[model samples]
Target chain A: MQAGKPILYSYFRSSCSWRVRIALALKSIDYEMVTVNLIKDGGQQFSEEFQALNPMKQVPALKIDGITIGQSLAIIEYLEETRPTPRLLPQDPKKRAHVRMISDLIASGIQPLQNLSVLKQVGQEKQLSWAQQVISSGFNALERILQSTAGKYCVGDEVSMADLCLVPQVANADRYKVDLTPYPTISRINKSLLTLEAFQVSHPCRQPDTPPELRA
Target chain B: MQAGKPILYSYFRSSCSWRVRIALALKSIDYEMVTVNLIKDGGQQFSEEFQALNPMKQVPALKIDGITIGQSLAIIEYLEETRPTPRLLPQDPKKRAHVRMISDLIASGIQPLQNLSVLKQVGQEKQLSWAQQVISSGFNALERILQSTAGKYCVGDEVSMADLCLVPQVANADRYKVDLTPYPTISRINKSLLTLEAFQVSHPCRQPDTPPELRA
Candidate 1:
């Protein structure tokens, strides 16, 4: 096992990186954060050193167990395996699948569509509308799914990987100015989740790298 | 277990649906295909009946064990759990995590950005370039990751979940004309994967619902 404290190569504003940061805090894994400014120097994540850690050149690459793991969900899975305390996924097969379904809906279905890279590609004129449409479509599904699966959280009372992924994507949705009025369950869950210390401290604004003006 | 063949609610052209189709074939699980015709009836997936099966209103929702599972990867995971004979994920934790990393890079990183809904929203003009850029960026990392993780397949010779996720994504890349020459390993692996009968049968062109003219 890697002896040193785990290091997270991340940026404050990246929703993908935020998912990892929340997960690390949820699992209570102490790790050092090395910010990779996604905007500065045409993206610090493109640097050779960072690329070596994560060839994807994406942030939230965790250095642990003498190995570097990229992909926020993948890193969270590794952490879950190594540190099972306060589990991030449900034990039941169906519930676990349910949790993953919601997580994937956000991670793959929502987040990628409205990501900064995508927004930039769409340009300023259409970016907001484009992102809102994507997030709105996803939130519609999320609200319906939560009708049966949710109870104080995305999936029943306990926090699963779904919650970790949920809060960040919702945060992004807010940034994209997507109306949450149509998604009562999602808004309720987001409100409840943000009240917790784990979710509180991991918010993008509270991160060490968050810009002063953006800080809450 | 519920009797009869499992039902796959899918559309032939969906790359995400193709992933599950390949996985079901790989595991030798008999599943009946119910074509959803993503292009017709203003997209049948958005219909209330379809939404009941999958709140996300996405294709490749599987009906098995008396429960409908949405999300292609989540469906695959459920299938992996119910039928473990032909393992889709690696046995080792690290290797499994590695396999999942590549899967997410495609599933979450690339696929969603170029999804049909997103494409329609981006408008006809910029769609092709938008998709190509996203695929190109993802392929750059996939190529690098495969350098170490690949050996005859995406993870040391065995056809893990990574390959299943890869083949379909690469298919989308080809459709968008992403220019595969820059990524040798991805092309090589895609070539190897396509050679398998399971992959062949699960191909979009070979699906039951594929238009006759589009059939391979």
Candidate 2:
């Protein structure tokens, strides 16, 4: 990154941002952190400057070597591609598909349903418990898939892209009071992953921009 | 396809299932459509047999060449990897990541929030308008993304995985009465994509498995 380190526009509690953070750290790529508080004065992400960076006005947008990118799964894949030294995806096509599948399972299926914005919407018009129930069902489904597919990580023994996606969502789920017992495999994988330096350094609680109220 | 074509466990109205169907048709790979009704008898997708194939018990599960894969994004990607003749993803990593980002924006970001399950949760407990608002806001964000990035297709000229994801989700947004006028780019892209043989043939209304009552 001769042009300079990638700049990540992120918020501490944003699971999507956390996924990208883990990926950058895993690849050992140097990058500057640009905090975008999601809850301050109607979201810093919606600021004109940030919106230009990500028109979607969401966290986890990256400006890498002058090019800006968004979406956690895509950002992680980009890192895996550009920094191929310590690979985050398997080389085999089938294995790569499996890895992508696990990542999508979380990125597409589970995480979105329980995102902060969605829950805020639920709380406004629907009941908080109702949103939690919807989130729990998503988690239950995730746990079931992880049971057969996971081994130390989301896909297999390797620390693939799936694990990066999995850990943060699991962290968010626990905060919502989700029971981890039903998803033993997911819980086990989370346990193994939390021990790693990549995940440890990327924890939301450690972020400089995390809200004081939510800090553990 | 030696085992009498792959069995696609799908729901006619499912956007996720529709994605895989389009991919299958694009490749000219034949598949047996096995309807798993999402609304009948508390969702047939939750049945023991279906759960055996997909622990998540969601439609658009593919039983391909002896192996079953769940999640539409995963299934389409698996096909892309396994059969590379007509590539769905670009060769360049940055471009591939761009395609995946657009796809992920729909798959993970937009589609999940407005799923039938989510709406059902809202209807079962909350007001109808509440659900519509959630769907509308998500679509609005999507429209913003489409406005800047989309060309004749989602990511410039080619028909890629993002197009497959875009059409189906747009269909769902229409079902919820979300207006298309605000999203001119999305509407324009949808119009062009609709003309394609793959999208036309794979349309839910054109599907043989679609119940007469649900046919548009």
Candidate 3:
């Protein structure tokens, strides 16, 4: 491990960054936050300095164990490998696969399609409907999967990585005004996960860069 | 383990499916391939029968150990856990993080943005340019990352999960006519990875459903 507290490059409203925040809190790992404003100064993530840290030019990059890891799931996996307390992935291979499937369903399948960069290309006139359509389609599948997988949380009651992915994405859905009534399972799981300290403390509304008006 | 051979729900041309195919080949695992033509019959993946297996309605779902695993990365992770030999993920924590970072850089960052479904929404007129732009921009970042991390392979000489992701995305790049010259590091690594039998046999051109005109 590194000698000092690890640092996290983050954007308050980024669902990807929020996923990492929840993981860091869940593992009880204290870290410094360096906010990379995704909107201001024409997206600070594109800045040369930030680009050096993450060539992908995205936030939620963690400086830990003397190395910087980008990608929320990768950082969380590293944390799980090194920390192993209050495990975010189940032990049984089959159960772990389920957690990962749900996580990727959100992380890769849904989140990427509706993120800021894609939305920028989608244009202002179409962004709302585009995000709504994307989120609803993904939620349709997620709802069915969660029907069989949920037990107070996504993938049983463990509050695994899937929960980390779920809560932030649901936040995005809310931002885009996607009707959640049709996705009862997703809505129920998000509601239950919101009550946890990890999810509460790591929420976008509670982050350092969260605007005063948006802060909880 | 299950009494019978595992089954892979796949489409020949889906990069995501090709990813799982490469992993299965590397692990030397015996599995049955059930082709789900993504285009035929208004997209077979959307069929109720297929949705029952993978609520996400995506190819590359694996039925292994008596449970259905969706998402290529999730399936690959499961195979790595159970098979272990000729490991797809490195054992070192930091190295593993790098492998995952690269894998996701392509899988989530690059692939989903230009996928057939996304392109369908992008429309036939804009599909080519749209795919070119998405792939080129992603490759710009990936090329920079690979400049430092790569050595014969994406992360050192070993063929980790990152290589599995790189080769398939490079194939997609080829299909889209994205100039490979700008990304020498990625091109070189991909060129080396292509020589392996696992990559050749699992290639989109050689799959069971590969059209006669497109077959190598």
Q: Give the TM-score of candidate 2.
A: 0.93
Cα lDDT of model 1 by residue, B1-216, tens digit: 678788999888898898898998888888798999988889898888888889788898988887778988888888787788789888887888889899999998889888887788778998999899889999999899999899999988899889989998988998999899999999999999999999999889988899999998
Model 3 lDDT tens row, B159-181: 99999999999999999999999
- Model 3 chain A poorest ten-residue lDDT run: A148-157
Q: Ten-residue segment with the worst summed lDDT in candidate 2 chain A? A: A125-134
Best-fitting candidate, scored by DockQ? 3
Candidate 3 docks at the CAPRI level of: high
Task: In candidate 1, list every pair of residues with a backbone clash.
Answer: none
Measured by TM-score, how close is model 3 to the native structure? 0.98
Which pairs of residues have clashing backbones in candidate 2? none
Candidate 3 — which residues are off by over 4 angstroms?
none
Candidate 1 residue-wise lDDT, A1-216, digit = tens = 769999988888888888888888888888898999999999898899888879887887888877778888888878888789899888887888888899899888888788777778788998888888888988988898899999889988998899999898888888878878999899999999999989888888998988999999
Q: Which regions of candidate 1 deviate over 4 angstroms?
A: B1-4
Better of 2 and 3 by DockQ: 3
lDDT of 2 at A176: 74
Pitting candidate 1 against candidate 3, the one with the higher TM-score is 3
Question: How high is the TM-score of chain A in model 2?
Answer: 0.93
lDDT of 3: 0.92
| After superposition, candidate 2 runs with Cα above 4 Å error | A124-128, A211-216, B1-4, B124-132, B213-216
In every candidate, what fraction of the native interface contacts is reproduced? 0.79, 0.71, 0.86
